[model samples]
Target: MPRYEYRCRTCGDTFELSRPMAQSSAPAACPDGHEDTVKLLSAVAVGGTASAAPAGSGGGCCGGGCCG
Candidate 1:
């Protein structure tokens, strides 16, 4: 299951729900009893251990040096 963020248009309340991907865009009701909720676009972050780059090798494009 994937967690989805929803925002209620009527009450301006936001909430999260874990459901199947097939229902990602399905209609959802807000906790405040508002049915005019819409799914909000959210970012997903993937994390990993940072490793040092080899000598003379170009680091990450951002130049943060987190080139693993």
Candidate 2:
């Protein structure tokens, strides 16, 4: 399941919901029972390690400082 952010125009409140991607475009009501709501744009962050470059290398243009 993915989480989505929403804002209620009636009460000016923001909320979140966990739902399937199919229903991501579906309308959602606010906690205060406000039907005038709109989905908000969300940003995703990815974190990981890069192993493309070997140790003791500058990892430059060719990952081996060859372009220098």
Candidate 3:
């Protein structure tokens, strides 16, 4: 199951729910019992930063002493 973000047009409430992909865009009742709701775009968890060094950089002090 995938998570989806939803916003309620009636109560102006925002929340997330885990449901099947088929229900991703289905109309869902608000937690406050409101029947009018709209599905919002999902947000990314993180920026996906790379922590390791790039390939072919080599294990040297300054690119094989080019800067030395």
> Could you tell me which residue pairs clash in candidate 3?
none
lDDT of 2 by residue, 1-68 (tens): 89999999998999999999999999999999989999999988987668444565765576566775
The residue-by-residue lDDT of candidate 3 on 1-68, one tens digit each, is 78888889988999888999987878888889898888898657875448866754776766555564
Full-model lDDT, candidate 1: 0.87
- The window of 10 residues in a row where model 3 has the poorest summed lDDT is 59-68
Give the residue spans of candidate 1 off by over 4 A: 48-68
Model 1: per-residue Cα lDDT over 1-68, one tens digit each:
79999999998989999999999988999998889988999988987647856555656555655656
TM-score of each: 0.67, 0.67, 0.60
**Alpha carbon lDDT of residue 49, candidate 1?**
46
Candidate that beats the other on TM-score, 2 or 3, i.e. the better one:
2
